[model samples]
Target chain A: MSRESVVGTAEHAAESEWGRLSSRLILVNLAILVAPVVMFLADLAITGDAGLQALITLGSLFVTFLVVSGIGLMRLFTTRYRVTEHSVELHSGLLFRSRRSIPVDRIRSVDLTANPVHRLFGLTTLSIGTGEQSTSASHRLALDGISKADAVELRRRLIEARDARRGYAVPVEDDGPISELDWSWLRYGPLSVWGVGGVLIAGASVYRTLHELKVDPLKWGFVKDLEHRFGSVPLWYGILASVVVLVVLGIAGSTATFIESWSGYRLTREEGGMFRVRRGLLVTRSVSIEQQRLRGVELVEPIPLRWARAAKLNAVASGLGSLDDNRKRRMLTPPVPRAEARRVAAEVLGTDRSLVLRTGLTRHPRAALRRRVNRALMWTVLITAVPVGLGLWLGPGLVRGGLIGGAVLLLVLVAFAVDAYRTLGHGMRGRYLLTSSGTFAHRTVALRQEGIIGWKITRTPFQRRAGLFTLGATTAAGEGVYKVHDVTDAQGIALAEQAVPRLLLPFLERDPRSAARG
Target chain B: MEDVRLRPPRHRVESRAVNWWRLQSLLFAVPLPLTFGILWASIPPTRQIFMWLTLGFLVPGLIYVLVMPPWRYRVHRWEVTDEAVYAASGWLWQQWRVVPLSRVQTVDTLRGPLQQIFKLSGVTVTTASASGAVKIKGIDHAMADDLVAHLTRFTQATPEDAT
Candidate 1:
């Protein structure tokens, strides 16, 4: 009999139970249910009120964990799934009774994730994303805490089922390592601006967590005996020591996150035009992108990364929703050299195409440079005037200090403005618009002009005086709008008209010389 | 698409839009200045500074309520073609947008309770642009309907291009 015939004959067909280890995995959730009681115990300890009340509280906490664990265990026993030729069915919920089925063809990606706990237990949580950007949380079906063997088997069956339904084995061919973990890139890892702040925040939270448990953090992890011991050292020495220690901690934290997220990062071009990036050490993440969904790529270079000549490659894929709060920017490559980033961008966008991301950009008019400089000077004066004005009003001591500080600040501002002006470039090559702009962390995006849905022209009173306008090419792809600010009015209009041809040309009043340049 | 004209639009909105905008200006102006006066009146140290700045602000605003409405009406222009919708607004700091009909996600007609009293309407064309919606206010009711119908039909006729 055919597969359909066999499924039809069976009763509730091919229902299978996950491994018994899933019950043990569910026990971890008991801690959440009993956390309040634990906090109460900590409070009692701190207050020195450890009597019958403390014993009773501890007993109640134990009972709560027991009951929660029992419910979690019950859930695992009740859950069952059926994999048919057409659909994958899941049934759970003891009292409410919920059933969900995903059609084989609708499955976009099957990803496996595991935390440190799950890794120790040899378990995996499989998530099936339908590639839907809906607000509904049910867009992904997650099978929580299954045996490694069963999870692997289920993943294979689901993929094979999908393949059988569609009739082809998507090549899982090895593409011979696109990128490898190297210490050279590690230097850029800690160079992110967020690192120091992230480390400090994380450290404060950890200290708070320990404090809540009535555990002294100074004794717990941070340098011990520094509580009152810091007073013995000279103030400057203490401050300097702490600064050095904090910087070391920040760099360490940055490297840890970098390794945790992109340690085993590999980008492989699979069969049937699907590319997958599998990385992370303790908590693994596997992101897959279809060739058809990819509109373009973005080179993200933070100020420090830029100075180091390194950039991270992020994909501009359609219908791709972001995942995780951090570490989930849909990146294609780790922090690599600028040359390699350009090469990879070309490769991702396809070298087969006439348009490449590494095209020479056209510089905007001299007026744009002047406008940037003007803006910088205006900001400098506004910032400096506040202190200097207060200095004049308050006393003469502040006047001397204010002038010296203001002059230094003005010089820095001028340098940044000149750099920003130098960075201003816009080019249209083939079907792409290659635009570059930024004072510090410069980004050069090669966006497809066809992806642009609209155009916005902005001209302030000052800009109008300078004959400058900001042209934003609005697309659905990367970060939405790519703007070339402070371009001459004629250039802005011309860029819009040339990028989209007939669309913007209809509304714009054309000037022959600028039109030809665009 | 190639046959589209590069000519500037000649159509002006209904002349009554000037009165409506002035009314809108009044609607916006009254509460804000009154709130400012109340706030600065209650405060002690900055009362003198507030009075001067408020006058500095209110003089231009009073001029706007009386004079800038007609000036704004003179500048604001909108036009629609089979391919796209165009709008130009603002007097000093001018802004314009050409939202391709093919990229329009939604088209809406807006008539507030006050706007309805004037027998006037406004149309908003939403595209996938981060710069926000293209809103053409102070339109004739019948003209608004025509715009909505035309934009709806035009957008529907074009197949969605994948991002």
Candidate 2:
């Protein structure tokens, strides 16, 4: 029977209808497995390697493909999903048949993704997230290679069902989008550390791959000529020239990636209290997060972006996925002007003004600065000692190099320490608690005060001597713990009390003698 | 400076927890010296160095077994109130954690073989946040049960989503 006829009959016969995934999923799976084999065969044909061994290898590959495709076909036919009044259920697997039923009210997010191949086939993968902290397989459900339209319909139906269960007011009319891509934001792309880092990583991998194949770049005539040219120039000038070239290439690469990843980026607030992000050039993505799950927003400014007056925004939400996945899925906006980042953050949090961007953050005590400086000095001694000790054992030529490197390192590290101290601050504004820190990548998190579930106070021997402590406000959002480093003991207690008023009062004591009663 | 300190949590653990810790450390400590002693006797060339190693491990392990239990007893404390649970743990590097009753997700009592020998149980109070779990070890078994019951009641009373 046709898929539609089967679904229609099930709907008429039962309270919920079982729907199959797109049959084209089998073709897509086979194509993914076959493409590489075809390329390998083409390469063999070009090299005229039609030996008996080659024929045997090709036969085995064909057999493997058939076995894999058989499994894929069975999976495609067996998988089915159905939505009832109170829950959504999925039944799948061949030898290890399994069933999953998730309550409608527990569903937290519905995300749609399609790579270039899937998009070419008009298919998308839908993942249903319940926001459980456990990473067990049963907690995750993904429908692979469904028709894009069907995926969208399923996502909407699931969300609507959840909203209905929660007794939410009916969804209102769509209000355009909250934010959209601004091409000018691409200017900040080249200012990110990733611009240079990405180039280095890609270049290293390509070189390594060639080396693995016994190809040497140094043996090439053009590379030898370039080396000769560099040899003739002064050492510092040659280094400068190479750095300039690397930067130019890095900028071009980052700008291209920025365009490809965020070409049609749009952030829209959907009808039923969900925020949807749609972006990507070739492999499009649509992520929908329940508005109620968002605990806060964070404004991230790497050193280079901060210097360029730019920043990015991320949502501090629960159930985005594991820590790494949460970080990737939480991106609300790519690098944008600081003002735009703040505006978007404010919009996302539904606040009048972005509290993290506000001024007059409470400065940490001077002891914090002392602690940082002490740590910086200790690191300098440890690092400098390494090279100096090596030089002493090696030769005088290395001694001069060690001295110069140590001098530069000392300057950079001391400056970094001071900047780290300066960036540290914590404050409360309205209903949100704000904590800002980090020097390499400064993050100012505006966490909802009501969302703070616990407090952790840590004191090291050094911190005890300085009368300073680190206070971590624990929540289920973002990194789970946003710490205010090197605050005085009194300040940590005061801030914790102020952030969650009555939780700590019962445990606090003003006098030591009275503390004996606990 | 005096006003800055936290009032230590209310209750000390069962005193026999010290013996449990001491036995646990001794169990770990005996292995190293024994291994080194066997090596020293079996290997001729490395005997001198191995002998020194045996002494090295044995001396410090003995000291740790003697010192750590009582020191940890003084440091580890826990108190539960109507509104929140508070705990202080660790020696040298210390931490105080406070989790509100409204945000508690689960309360579990764990008793290992050694803890059973000492009639001690450990209670773990989990909040919505992964890192916000408060663990109180070395409490009387009966006291741990009462704490778990008390916490469960408070958590159930506030049936809001902790996240």
Candidate 3:
């Protein structure tokens, strides 16, 4: 049974459930756009300038409503799919019509997902990905609304096509109960709080920057000459202005965060090796990720979650081909605790319980030294400049500032060394090497024997002289790169040989180099 | 296998192309960075590092042009034999990946400006649990249309092999 057969009949049209779901979305989007219009009207009523201002706000809302309604109508009416004997046909688009037929044999995987709304409405969305590039097809298909019987039958047929091939495992029947971690681990901790705070601050800063950029010559005083610029304003006035701006920004940023991150978070693994993750406040999203698309597990134990015997578990999936692109993304699960991360990773990757890929704990020898030195120097410079900078900020002559700078410089040097020491100590621990050497937010991706796809060992001219080489393993999800900064060629070969066999076995039976020739 | 070769009534073009605007900001590209480097050389923090990294950015593109073998590369012409679909590309060191259609998990097409301009597109063929996916690049649009039709047809007809 290949992916093609899973999405069988191209015969079905927009009948019952799909129509209802699409209409609901149109209504939801309409409600979301109503806030700004109401706010605008209230502002106009208070100021008695309701004519131009209210019209502009109302017009924008109307346009927004039209766009959302248009997309909903298009999906409801235009999008249709049919499952064929050995393939699936999808017809989509409004003006630029498209018809995609994907054979059952070529399908890699099919994922089904639904949110709380989708669950209540008895509808699920499906994403089917194949190994080819076709314009007529979409990676995702919204069933809108369908019976449970139809959904199960679709899954069964798709699995039959996919499993028709040998070596591929039959779709697992027992996804197992939502683990204890799902119930206990998901929490909004300090990092989540700080992350929310950071977003707030950034948003406020952007708003302020835009406001400042809208320089009003008449109100700010027409500045025709450099001498009369705002920089020449009184020192007290400058100090007061800066303080007011900072306070306003700080408050706005914090407020923005409190509203955005409200969560009705839920993570569940179904009986069919599919993980469903749905969360978000005003704008909700639901993603169903196939187990095969699972990339790797990220366990972050920041200061806040650490004390609660907790950590945020983030599963990076493959649908987002590159972090730089792809708006529709999937996560095996959101930030759960650290202890649960390993178990979740195992379930998602379908690896053994003990097989953990350690992607951290290696350093690029020269790069490591350079980073530490740079950090040390920066701290020294900051300390040295502080007292002198304070003298200029406060007054021209202010209390023997040179001595103060020297004392601060000594303290900074001590702090820098301690911070650099912990960062330098980070390294990888798994059977396959993954080196994470960065001083802050250090991460490396290591895979056990099963997770890796293929391994390549290569050395550059400069690296050869330094007796160093890099081993990069391409995973289904992303690139797994490990650089042995100063290891011998023999060691490099030994590691590559040992690792490649494990990685290559599932893909090709013979040695890859010889297989390439054959 | 004999029935698989029978042609369908319609031969449609299958393509997914991302326009040039889809690529990352041009400010990070070599030409823009080089221009910025020379202009900002006198400014603080821009003298040495900016110029050096800007020059370094050209290495990948230069290496690609120089080392790439002049094969009449067409990603669209990729074929799926009864056993496998042969997707191969490379200029310096070559890569040939054979993905049995039975093992295929996902098929994706990407079209960037270079591909869009040339009416070409790249196809990615992936298999379950294996990241050794095959990519075929620089195929013309018309050729891609025929290839996708044949490949999908072949995949449907062939019985699943031991992947």
Candidate 4:
């Protein structure tokens, strides 16, 4: 009866928004406000004339209704989105007149999320993300309040458009939905450092929020309860006790978060060569990536996870998602057994190249080992000296702690350095190049040599003096550049030559004895 | 045992590009300290410290700007081959990079105002690499065009490979 009465104008080239949604939005919002509104009305009736209060209430509501209806009208008729042959163009804003278009070829993923309110109205919010844009604009192109049918249709059309551009046979086949989150995997959640980190972050945020609100957390009911439970403890003991409590809480919080995120996880390899993942307990997320977009796979083993013989598998794809944002949907497997991860990676890639990471890893030269050792020693010295200096500056109370801490840290660093060296290996099995390295989080990458676009050879003054150079393989996929460090110049060039043959051959001199010089 | 020496690249950037870089460095280095010097001179307590700091930054900076152009000219080298484009550059430590003819997505040439004055041009070869686009600066105008033309021909001939 209201805003849907308005028809789309000629200037509105794209189709109009769905259903206005005024009835739904108003009903939901009004229902939420009803309790407070009723309380206010009762108070007004008690304080003033009942009839006048009712009249005022009706007047205000009529005004709210008019305003909401106007907005719904403008939104219904003015806002528009269209799937053109080549692009998804969205136009909104009445006065400013904004138009944004994402080319169909560039659309990497379209994720749909619908809350309870949206589900009631059969609506979904679409997040259209493109892989290659330098700005956050690529991640946040959301189309809100679209019909579920239209959303499905739009995704199909966009996929079709991409297929047309790519000249690939498109199949809508959905295959065996394998691999759900195992309750046993819950063991890995508590083992992760991310749990402790999440706890610390939550505490910091809560502390900040309390400060912003000008509320003293110490005087709060929980703190009082904690204090009562602990009794009047001494200062140092109080600190230690709180620290232990916080750590336990953090572990619990992190474990809960992991379960929530990974529960009901399912992976499906469809007939059309797309790997679709549907996961999440509270907010269900569906991600489908075509096999054509995948470049390689990475096996990441954080030190603790490694200790447990567990690893996480991530797909090295153009626009799978951002790691900085902790979008671990890119991860093929959670912290599972290393062997299990390998199997999962093999299944996901659907190729024999997945086996390349496990075997035939050629170790880097002795010079690389020396470099790591020296670097580790240098860092140990530098880091220890700071604490030593601080102890000296702050007087003698901290000297023993500083010295012990420094020694322990140095020991850890030394072990880490040796592990890093142990991890340093690269292998080439035909077109596939396998490289694995790291200290805390060892990563093994299996990439295609043909995928390499360029070679960047760099030698620091120190590296040059040591006759060593690093060769970074550049590609459009993954983190962009994968580096092989501290190799002899001959080895580096030889590696590059093998990676992309004629490209480096034209530049390298025939002689191999030339050592790098600063 | 075969011995290898640093074989110089086939083409060197225009000598004037050195001056342009120095000029560019000067453009960057001069204003901030000059503004800070004026601000420091306006206040009495900070004047000596400001003078000392400005001298500290500018003296070495001016020396660096002047010396770097020619020293950079000494090191800057590039060669465009039938198979790839190679650029050898850097200051303390050098890097020699190779971007094959097949991988280059776009070849863009820019002529900044100072570059125009120096009769120099810069070419950037953007490939589909995460390391990002490679830039070769201080080419003579004709050479830039010739390089671009050659790259265009190669790019057109092999669109099937790298992308």
Model 4 regions more than 4 Å off: A1-108, A113-123, A128-142, A147-150, A156-175, A210-214, A221-236, A319-329, A353-359, A393-401, A512-518, B1-8, B27-71, B161-163
Model 4 C-alpha lDDT per residue in residues A1-518, reported as the tens digit of each score: 02121123334443343222223443434443455356556545444544554556656766776776566555555666776666766766576565666777767767666665566666666777666523344345666667778777777777777778667755645545656677888888777677767878887887764443334467767779988977877788988987888778777986887777677777777534567676666655667665766777889999888899888887776664443422444766667888778877777766653563644677777777778878888887787787678889997757777778778877888788888988987767666667888888998887777778887878787887887788888877667778886777666666666777656655555444434431
Which sections of candidate 1 miss by over 4 Å?
A1-25, A31-113, A117-173, A207-242, A322-327, A352-359, A511-518, B1-29, B35-76, B89-94, B127-131
Which of 1 and 4 is ahead in TM-score? 4
Every candidate's CA RMSD: 6.1, 4.6, 12.7, 6.9
Models 1 onward score TM values of 0.79, 0.88, 0.55, 0.80
- Indicate the worst ten consecutive residues by lDDT in candidate 3 chain A: A502-511
Which of the numbered candidates is closest to the native, going by highest DockQ? 2
What are the per-residue Cα lDDT tens digits for candidate 2 across A1-518? 12121122234545346777898877776776566466556645555555565556567768888888788788888899888667777778878776767787888889999988888889999998878654543357889888998998998899888888889855656767888998888888788677777889999987774444334567777899999988899999988987998898889888878887888999998867888999998888888877888988888999989999998889988877666667768989989998888888788788866576736899999988888888888888888888788889998867788788888888898899999988988888888888899979999998888778899989898998987888999987767788888887678778887898877777767755435655
Worst 10 residues of 4 chain B by lDDT: B1-10
Highest-TM-score candidate: 2
By summed lDDT, the worst window of 10 consecutive residues in model 1 chain A runs over A1-10
| DockQ, cand. 1 | 0.38
- Can you list the residue pairs that collide in candidate 2? none
Which pairs of residues have clashing backbones in candidate 4?
A: none
Regions more than 4 Å wrong, model 2: A1-16, A38-68, A136-138, A170-173, A195-253, A511-518, B1-4, B26-37, B47-67
Better of 3 and 4 by DockQ: 4
Error of 1 at B152 (Å): 2.6
lDDT of 3 at A458: 43
lDDT (C-alpha, whole model) for all candidates: 0.71, 0.82, 0.48, 0.71
